[model samples]
Target chain A: MRGPDAHGRFGPFGGRYVPETLMNALIDLEQAFRQCIDDQSFQEDLHTLLEEYAGRPTSLHEASRLSDALGGARIWLKREDLLHTGAHKINNALGQGLLARRMGKRAIIAETGAGQHGVASATVAALLGLTCHVYMGEEDMRRQQLNVFRMQLLGAHVVPVTSGTRTLKDAGNEALRQWVAQVEHTAYMLGSAVGPHPYPMIVRAFQRIIGKETRQQFLARCNTLPDVLVACVGGGSNAIGFFDAFVDDASVQLIGVEAAGSGLDTDAHAATVSKGTPGVFQGSLSLVLQDRHGQVLPAHSISAGLDYPGIGPEHAYLHHINRAQYVAVTDDEAMHAVEVLARHEGIIAALETAHAVAYVLKCAPRMPRDAHIVLCVSGRGDKDVSTMMAYKEAHA
Target chain B: MNALHTTFAALRKQGTVACIPFVTVGDPDLEVTRALLPALAAAGAHVIELGVPYSDPLADGPVIQRATARALAHGTTIGDVLQLAQDTRIDGLDVPLVLFSYINPIMQYGINALIADAARSGISGLIVPDLPYEEAQDVRATARDHGIALIPLVAPTSHARIASIVAHADGFVYCVSSLGVTGERASFASEGFALIETVASLTDVPVCVGFGISAPEHVAQFSRCCDGIIVGSALVRTIEQHSEALLDRSRRVQATRDVAHFLRTLFSQSSGGAQ
Candidate 1:
């Protein structure tokens, strides 16, 4: 009930629906993950790397100015943006990179949307001296050119995917294809808590450091648990990591904010939980934005990371069972949150993270003045400076 | 016996390997696909695999992906392809038809309803590349109830899994020729032959080699061991090459003939006489 069952189903939302060729590999991966997690040396190495290399125990800072500006709940920010790759994605990337190395794979392949994961994977590959290939959508490469260059600069070959709306979904398909072609020597370093079995569980486990540290830090600093926990849900990596530790606590409210590109009323939103149906997508059964005939619909968002048609299956399961609540925030609202965070807290939060902040901005003022809310600022928004400037010019 | 079982049984009795040709329905539109089915049968296809164009086809390479894009561009769906099957059956087509699809479209169509309709539409078998043996229980059970063969695929990596995967395999065991998506490979390693031998050792069902089988030599090579050979991307590539001709009213017949001619040459090289 906390994680997936033995067969990897979070109820009916997650299962291994992949080609026969990948089945044995998945089995091997699951076994390796189980072994590695239990091994003390593996955990020690991971802990050392997190502390020394990638910077662990990311600070949970209470934003007094931002909280006072909101005038209701006192807001805390989980500072995932301060990690080595400027995002929480490094947690899973490093974990998977180590797993791949332990599996005797010399090369790693990954799919990226906004390119934060690509950069994280590339950085890990560079540090570990493994060959890396990052499959990115052509459109994403264009929009996130800075991160694209960062991946390339890290010695990762960036392959542009031009199929299927020229976005993250197509990048995923291309990565799977290439992984199939060279699965013998390569390991797929999946970016998020999506994909087939063991992946959601694995990513959540790797990223649980976030929630673990946050819980300890918040309780130590405030002498009590936060009343509310919020994180943006793009494949639900950071959000899942942040929520897993508190899933059993009935007193804490967990909210996942989805990207509403224009609005949920329009056809152009990436709000999967807001407007999606159960379908198999990218190796897992989850809530997907697809046509009536099951063709995946193109998702749109100012933030490339959130522009995905499918949500992570665990999040779908959580939503289905009413363990968590999911809400949507529009691009404009997210952009406004970006500006507010920058002005009030000197934090340039990623657009994906801004969705969470935007939702808190709307709801915090209505909560009790003593209520506490922890928001996951999942990534830095330096990559979005250009997009932000362009948006401002257009609006002006 | 079902059409798939009957076709494979007859092929084994005749001491010849079956030739299975795959095409994406609604590529260059549905009418050409309709014409290609019977044409492929005439060109000695023992069974035909109809690929449903999906939005995301992870098991396919660029060639079939392009075919899918073309097919989906025209708004092709599982319903439309099944309708095509019904129409072709009405046109007196006798070759066994296997619907090769990714699992999403079928899940969207509602599994029970799709299987019943597929049975009614003369679809002989189902091949969902994404549905491995473990997750295929409900789909397999439904297809079994409807008397449709849910063909299973085995790869070199399938190793000890081959037996359990083929435990309830109906129709033929689809043996992936290599460890990759569907496309043409310059040469195949002996791993394919070993995998096929292992699969044959496990199941009584006929084993067919597919994935990366492009030329006649590949078919001839695989025909020596397997009960059949499946040609997907190669034949779909042929359709792609003739897409301009297929879309033209005046050149459509010639293009269809050319495709049949290509299949004939490919089949002609196969020493197996069953097809």
Candidate 2:
């Protein structure tokens, strides 16, 4: 059946590998989450927030021009970019924010790389009137100053993490450290399907709205499920959410795209599923880009959102069981897809989302003309315009 | 009994509190780590916890975190640390060696190989902060097979679960002095002592309190309730302060002596100062 049994294991991955100080808190969180799942008021509150606040049921649009350009399968876009926060991150943020309020936590803390999750968490904290602290790597803060400022404008204190690579991995370490120190009154609003037990399960549950809506919309429009689903994998939150509803469907091929910065032969990349090995990272056993000494290596990517060394333990499980296929696309390919999408569909996609689009551009042409493929556009590209321009200037 | 248990037993018999000092191996370099071990032993450390530098040390605060970074920057690995331990013992450092590490490095080294090597190197115990009670059964069993004590850490948050957490615990129970990562703190949590007391009540093994313990006052306070006191971040910070002197070939001996002096003064206030 669906994994992560009582001990939070999927085969051999996913467990609470945190310090003893957070064990009781995790157990209580798990209990509270289980109760919230069955509580009618909690469900209604979450649904109402998702619908009235975050804007649910994001449209599934037919990308006929892009489809014809690829010249094989019809391409459909799950428009999570249309969400209020300009990303699918709002769904989990609102859900977890409600949970934190229910748990009577006075404050919320989170870590971010590309800063979409930080902004979304700050938005929720502002909506719920909770004090929020967002830990961001110094480098990410430099790269995503706009999102960082957006979080500050939403009334969240942004703490810069300067330890170990000064990126998402270090940001996560710093956040967890803060959470441990402040577990009494704080709820760590983990933004992805990584970390310890119950988090992967919790985030997946909150984000499953993507797959749920896509299923109903696809059936209503096409009268059949799409042949394949594609989404980029950082910590695999959006991909896991997009794949949840179709996991049991034997014919629905699940494809997760990982960022291969430069190339896999080089040291710079975030292709955890493709190049990583099983190891404990950020409180869970997962596919991690680490040295032979088991020290986590820094991951590089054009997309700050996808520059992470660890994959979600659930994604690692899915890969292990052969239920899903993972592929890597270089920064150049993703950049090319960004241009192609903007030209063909008049849509600007985040660099992270372009990884999925890059994969679709490659595989859609190989499939039958009648076959349909759905790609998750996880975020808008407003946050990446400056980065793109800089890259262009450097390359030119 | 193993070296850890025997050491604790002897300290219990003598009515003296066990003083454990932690140092990150190869912080400046392995030569300094080798020189510091005997100094710590001479400074009245009953057992020394040698920290293996890891890229991601989540359970550590800024002090030890920086220490690990420095150690890793010098290219320190688990193998180097274990080799250092063996080398120091060959030079006649009699204190039991307890390895403090994250779980990933141990996994990379291979669990069976690690236990075997640790046993061969005369390592008495292991304290993997990330390997909590829930997922430690297999590792506990493996360490047991090799006569290595896989020390378990219990925190103030581990209420009602303390018994099961330390049921078959071997060397000692590491009681975290507060609800945070390792660093010196002005004061510990209100429930910290009660948690230690609760663990002492449940386990036959000696209970040692660590985390946020730096000052002699913290050592004296925890010594009243627990069998031993472990100072990590504070000690690591001391080594860091003297890292330049330690790295200097001519000044290394003085640096080691200074670190030992710091540990000595901290533990000198332990258990009514009978020592």
Candidate 3:
């Protein structure tokens, strides 16, 4: 991938696009980030927290039956799903929330769609003794009521946003507005590798530990980088974590799978990277699905997490630099992969991760024997079972 | 003459009763922005504050927040406002264009880049609400280098801070009429007149009171104390509420002319000392 500057500009994609009210906060964050990343005390603190508080070093398990079924490549799953909050989101949230406490911020605001990020933020807020406010789209609040209740139980005020398209985008917009107003005493804990400038860069730095550990583990086991790295793309946090370490490795191919509900030819899909054009949205230049008049179009997918009109700006830069390739997997294919993995390995994966599994299944068969591939098992499927059951009932 | 200085000089010559109107660029549409500016100029607006739409406008109340959202939804940017200023110049409008924005957009568009663009676009001045005097020196210097004025604000709360602000202020002192965000209040605070007098006593430059000076009576009161009265939220609220009617050609012209007539009445009455 092209080198992003300290200001988070990756080939004209990422930069600060927020209001002036947040400038001081951004400057403070930038300084804190530079100091904390290299400080030994900060590293030791984070290490202790990860080990004792967050349950770090999750297993890298080989799926033997799935590997045999796939016919050519050996597949291993890095199980981030088994983390405390059932996803990789907790890692970055816990890190940032701790830093917010260090900065003496009394409140935290976060935006979530499928509620994973909100739950993680709530978890950190409760642990750190800070008041937390989470903005979720009205539609997502109805769809992901369980996670919403989970956040409320953790003492976070779950605000339902009804503006714009009433989805993740609106929640993000509202969260930004709130941050701009209360930047003095509040910290906006962004969920993914998106948003303007320092957020995208800082968040990636926090999540890079995932790739660092996985790289060491893989090297110890197999003696080299895998031939291919696969991960699903929502706002592409998991994919970025898995891909960042190998960006300069020409021998390793990085592939990001997007949710293609039904088909790309159909209007019902969230294949933004696969079928999108570059435009400015949510404080960065990225691939967004828009009409002829430049009005952003609402994206659709069975996985609520992947149903966004734009990908992260860094992913857009990666695509532009040809360091990564993005492809779309249909809902039917992802669901089939979910069942196949469950029946074969007794592991039910989140639908977002199943998109990556489906791509691996499609591409693995054509690869040479002895090709090694690592897939990011991003989240547990407990939250998605109801949607999966409904899809099964309709199709059966 | 520099646009901001020219505006202040005009207000001083016109008996300390200048009328300043504010509008968000691309609120209803870009075309409305194009039409309303020249109309405000023709209708006795000595200085015009063109607001650049930001995603989060913390200091604005609901009316301007809604207007900002509308403008952002249309994909408005700082570049769009600069282009609008340039287009207005092509139409032969020579009024002082004071860009009223928060500092984030300018920083995002780089300080030097914005200053150069403002100069090329024929913009005369800038007012950044959140940019206090301490952080404003660099931007003010850049503006000065380009021959544009950086009009700094002096709030009532900033009592001891007024000297430094006035010393650095180039165009005029934007004396915030109240402590709160921009909106219309039922009555002008007696403290507002006091603050205006304090700022006027300290600065040789003209003082314009803003941020809740909406009604004719407020204008008259401000005219008695300050050099100019800037009416923002009230005028923005009227345009936002009447934007649909403005789609009709006759209604658009008539509505603008009606507002102009109202402003003229306020200016004349304020000058006449007939509250």
- Per-prediction DockQ scores? 0.90, 0.89, 0.13
Alpha-carbon DockQ of candidate 3: 0.13
Fnat of candidate 2: 0.87
Kindly indicate the candidate among 1 and 3 with the higher TM-score: 1
Worst 10 residues of 1 chain A by lDDT: A176-185
Candidate 2 per-residue lDDT over residues B17-103, each given as its tens digit? 898889999987888889999988888889999999998888999999888888898789999989998899889999899988899
Model 1 TM-score is 0.99
For model 3, the stretches where C-alpha displacement exceeds 4 angstroms are A1-4, A260-280, A284-298, A389-396, B1-5, B12-19, B25-39, B42-44, B49-65, B68-94, B97-234, B244-275
Using lDDT as the yardstick, the better of models 1 and 3 is: 1
Candidate 2 falls in which docking quality class?
high
What is candidate 2's TM-score against the reference?
Answer: 0.99
Task: List model 1 lDDT by residue over A1-396, tens digit each.
Answer: 576999999987899999989998899999999999999999998999999999987999989999898899999999999999999999999999999999999999999999999999999999999999999999999999999999999999999999888888889889988888787788999998999998999999999999999999999999999999999997999999999889989899999999999999999899999999999999999999999999999999999999999989999999999989999999999999999999999999999999999999998999999999999999999998888998999999
- Indicate which candidate wins on DockQ: 1
**Candidate 3's residue-wise lDDT over A342-379, tens digit each?**
99999999988999999999988888779899999988
- Please give, for residues A1-396, the per-residue lDDT of candidate 2 as tens digits: 897899998889999899888988899999999999899999999999988988888999999999999899999999999999899999999989989999999899999999999999999999999999999999999999999999999999999999987889999999999999989899999999999998999999999999999999999999999999999999999999999999999899999999999989999999999999999999999999999999999999999999999999999999999999999999999999999999999999999999999999999999999999999999999999999999889988
TM-score of 3: 0.77
Clashing pairs in 3: none
True lDDT of residue A213, candidate 3: 80
DockQ: which is higher, 1 or 3?
A: 1
